[model samples]
Target: MSHGVNNVRSRWTLPDYKPTQKYENAYRVTARFLLWVEKTKNRKVVDKLDAALRDGTYQPEMWVKLTGLTVDQLWKEYGDDPALALTYK
Candidate 1:
């Protein structure tokens, strides 16, 4: 979050540049989720699904059904890549 805020602050310091509240919020959310995914060693599909849930704009239960990962296991074994995780499926 600090990284994201610093990034926006740096940009704002530029002359004639103004950052919108909406843009900052969106980027902050994205950066935080990306940090979570990367540190968890999770892949794009799961990360996208997680982001969708965190944004609260969609119900991830349907995605869980399709992807075959319960919310608990999703967060637990996120260290594994999708293909490796799928092998145990």
Candidate 2:
């Protein structure tokens, strides 16, 4: 995946590097999810998951247990991009 860009010396070399359209779309979707998290506030469910992840105690079942929501539902609330529908599972 490095594709020789990891140690490139100059910013001009950046333009020579490009991901495929598939990767570009994936990046955009991930960015959208990140932006949603950044913009959202006072989300108690996400906060709990974040804390669990940071503390190394996160469990897949917690998605339903704590939030009373499926992973897909949480993702929908976060961004709900169609491209991300298959992302949760």
Candidate 3:
């Protein structure tokens, strides 16, 4: 009977979320892609992709092929929509 708080029994706890390898991989891929574009691709390429993302018509197949990730994975990393963001690791 030396407990500090015994008012009531509860099962509540704070969430301790951590990003998995998939998330790290996605982040790295996106960072590298952006850096590559910044170095080689012009602003127009980024602008076009931004427009496509806004319109929900973005297809990152070429990026996937180069990054060795699936379209779904790229989308999870680079998708503009919140719904798609929620699909991330």
Candidate 4:
């Protein structure tokens, strides 16, 4: 077999038991939101949001409105806590 085809299996292999993909999507979404916040507004909001995130009380909808994204989009993009997401509606 050619090396390219043979190595495909190796490339597809994930860590033996580690959930490396866990939170990756959330990180990506949060990173995007943070960058947007930093670019469009002062650091104060970012700092406040960061604090709220830690508190697990920040409704992602606020960011959704600021970013013009939909609740479903945020849901899929961030996988935010369902209870918090409910407040968005």
Candidate 5:
């Protein structure tokens, strides 16, 4: 039984997989936004974000309302933080 061979699931699980820069940037941005949300917002707002995501209703305006920051401001504040290094495969 070649369980090891069958166990392979997806390209992302491959050892040599490298995410594109766009994907990595998006991940970093989302992570930064979520961190901000956790730090500044209440649990109810987090719940709303979760629900909106689940329901396919999440929108940029929700972020603006919660963080009181526009997309440009978010990018300026968190997007270019060199500490948030991109992961390499």
Candidate 6:
């Protein structure tokens, strides 16, 4: 995701940016779950997440409220699904 973000930055002539990768795996898992949510529960969930994040009000409970799934449940359901893998073209 940071890779993609950097690509966008380069396209816009912004400075090259590198976000920390210490939580890459966590980011990937959360991304997969979000993809699942967008696929099965709410098509605008990513947008909602972005909005909440931008407002500094994002919370894990938001996922529960949106899909009735806890973080653990989301992981169990979508963690190993290759179809939801985060990919950059």
* Candidate-wise lDDT, in order: 0.42, 0.47, 0.42, 0.44, 0.49, 0.59
Question: Which ten contiguous residues of candidate 2 have the minimum total lDDT?
Answer: 14-23
After superposition, candidate 5 runs with Cα above 4 Å error: 1-29, 40-46, 79-89
Question: What does candidate 6's lDDT look like per residue over 1-89, in tens digits?
Answer: 32255544455321211232211356554454566667777888889879999999999899788778865665555544435434342
Which numbered prediction scores highest in lDDT against the true structure?
6
**Which model is ahead, 1 or 2, in terms of TM-score?**
2
Model 4 lDDT per residue over 30-55, tens place: 44444434444434666766778999
Question: 1-89 in candidate 2: lDDT tens per residue?
Answer: 22233334532222211222221345444444433443443246657877999999999888678656655565566543322221111
Write out the backbone clash pairs for model 2: none
- Evaluated with TM-score, which candidate comes out highest? 6
Which has the higher TM-score value, candidate number 3 or candidate number 4?
A: 3
**What does candidate 1's lDDT look like per residue over 34-88, in tens digits?**
3444444444655676677888866747446545654455434433332211111
TM-score, ranked from best to worst: 6, 5, 2, 3, 4, 1
Worst 10-residue stretch by lDDT in candidate 4? 80-89
Between candidates 1 and 5, the one scoring higher on lDDT is: 5
Q: Please give the lDDT score for candidate 5.
A: 0.49
lDDT of 3 by residue, 1-89 (tens): 12123323443221222233232455444443444343343435556667778999888664443455554554454333222111111
Please write out the lDDT profile of model 5 over residues 1-89, one tens digit for every residue.
12123234532321211222222355444544554445544335667778999999999788677667755565455435423222323
Off by over 4 Å in 3: 1-24, 61-89
* Greater-lDDT candidate between 2 and 6: 6
